[model samples]
Target: MKNDTPKVFKSIFALFVVAIFMIGLFYAFVSMPKGWGVNVNNRVSRLYILKNVRTATRLLDSGKFFAKGMKPLRAEVPYKPIKFKKTANLEDGAANVVTSIVVDYRGFDTLGEVTVLFLAASGVMMLLFGKRVKPKRKKTEPSLIMYVGTRIAFAVIFLFGIYIFVHGHLTPGGGFPGGAVIASGILGLFLGRNGYTPNHAGLKVFESLSGIAFVIIGLIGLFSVKSFLANFLPTGIIGNLYSAGFISLIYIAIGMKVGSELAAVVDSMIGDTKEEWS
Candidate 1:
């Protein structure tokens, strides 16, 4: 009864706080400048309409399907399709704008998101599964074809993942996809082998080092450029293999961290299953 009383009080207090927050938010919104929410000129829609018209006019006049170096006709448009098209390549050195946006513009947010993912994975492992136990099982060797095929596939998949992350600045794929691919490759090995146990120490070391490297790189950026995860290194030529400066480096770190973390998760799940079976 005493415990229930405290819980009831806590719930009531929480509801009160939420109500106060909502009232404050409503007041703030209503207190804003007049016509702030309404779109009079509708700049965004106008820009889109203008762009389409201009493109169609160019095609009709020149009798060509493609228009090269087509600049925005409107000087006072509120929104531009490519926000930093002119300076993105020069500033971030990434051929892909998505890479520039993720690693250069909103890097701190990405770091927080990655941290959250890692924490969620850890929490799931710890809370859902209390302790890990090794279950004794009959020793059985995998088929010759299965063993050989998995070995070859593992190497290829891992290398491909590395390639994806390394070329993230110039390509469509990035750290997250590459890391997932690598983790999937590792998972393949676990499924193929009977008593394959992932090296927890090695994975931990890789995860720790990559995480530390990411922080160190961010710290370096902070010290040099006065911003966290700022592009401190030289931005090489765009569309080149060795370009994008810190963006590629950060992607590499992210790939390693995510890959190791996911691999650890798979190992934990597998261990839990083994314990349950025993």
Candidate 2:
């Protein structure tokens, strides 16, 4: 009876704690500013910010064109649209507005996507967990020309991936595609050799550091500008290499993180897990 009493008390205490936590969570959500769920389709700010339209019916519903006292202009007022190759010294000045939107405006969403991918990879690794066993039969090794060609191809593919992400703000491709390309190169390396496995410790360290750098950059924006993942750096001339400020930096971090993570996934899947059950 005494032992059962303690167990019952513990269960009740845990339930009480959980109830308090739920209440706090509800309050926190309710405290958020009204209009947080504003419809994206109705907002003129996003369209104008991207500079896709030469003329707009209205100004941004929120945000400073240059000052805060200015409220969003109604349709009656003429809103000056940004010109390509002409608009310099604008905030989030990537020539490719899509990149600006992805890495700047919707950065938190990007982080969530990365997190989801991480979770998926972790799940895969956990499901495939087992002791690696060498095959009883000797596998045929790759030919010399095939091995040499794969190494050369991997180097080219790897560099192309780096180039894609590095120039993400100026081009069509970004971190996700760039990382996938790099992973494809790593896959090539695996095919080149019968017994090739990437360094697990190195991949883990690289992935952790990349994720940390991403969060740190976001924190810097949050502290400096009072907005998470806000553009805090000076945006240079449009269409220039260094124009996009931290958007490029964020993409680089994302590229590294996604690349390392996918590489780790590949390693986990391909490692010898087949063991003869006695």
Candidate 3:
């Protein structure tokens, strides 16, 4: 009863704090500036809403809002020194500006993101170490149907992943999504094949080599162009397979590194689980 008293008090206190927080949040939301809220009757507000609706309708009908020879919308005080869309292809040689930004203009940030992902994968393995205990029972083999289907699907999925990363400069997919897709294919193998296991040494080698290559490419840019991760190579023709200069190369490196790292993580996790069941 004494121990229960503290628990009850703690629960009540938590609920009270949550209630206070909710009230404050609601008050702040309601206290926002009047002009920010919907005003159907206001003349200026109606005109602004009608303008947005017309613009949206036009975009929906034409499948585009901006066209050649039309003046682009701009803020009274523009922030960027150079417009992004105007120079994206010229600067990075990528048809997809989003890819150009992710793999070229803001490449160092992407490198940091890759580092974080690698660390997370490594951390999972490290944290789960020494906790694996092999069971004293024999493991059963996977069904023939499952094994055959997985084998066929694995190749297709891996090829699709390769295609996504290879054409990232010209398409919607990039290194991160492509690597994740490749890792998913490896995971399918882990689940469907009874005796299949990823080669840890090979994954490590690939991961290390890819990471080193990315840094080396960045260093080359720094030395030759006075900028880290600068587009040192010729951009080539836009939308071509060989276009986008160093963007595709960096994305390839990132794809390899991420795919290997994630595959290693899945391997470690599945291996530990298999050991526990063994």
TM-scores for all candidates: the values are: 0.66, 0.73, 0.70
Stretches of candidate 2 off by over 4 Å are 1-78, 274-278
Which tens-of-lDDT digit does each residue in 1-278 have in candidate 3? 76466778899999999999999999998876566585444332332222233344455468454443344431111222323244333434677767877877678999899899988998988766654445445467778999989989999999999999999988899898899999999999987865577777899999999999999999999999998988799876666787778888888899999899889888777754423322
lDDT of candidate 1 over 1-278, digit per residue (tens): 75466778899999999999999999998966566576534343442322233444455477443343445433333332433234343545787766777787778989998999889888867755654555667477778788779889999999999999999988899999999999999998987877688888999899999999999999999999898888887776667777768988999999999999999888777764423422
Best by lDDT: 2
Global CA lDDT computed for model 2: 0.82
Q: How accurate is candidate 3 locally (lDDT)?
A: 0.76
Show the colliding residue pairs in model 3.
Answer: 135-278
Candidate lDDT values, in order:
0.77, 0.82, 0.76
RMSD of each: 11.9, 10.8, 10.4
Candidate 1 residues lying further than 4 Å off, grouped into runs, are: 1-89, 128-132, 136-141, 273-278
Could you give candidate 2's per-residue lDDT for residues 129-173 as a string of tens digits?
777876556567789988999999999999999999999998899
Residue 271, model 1: lDDT of 67
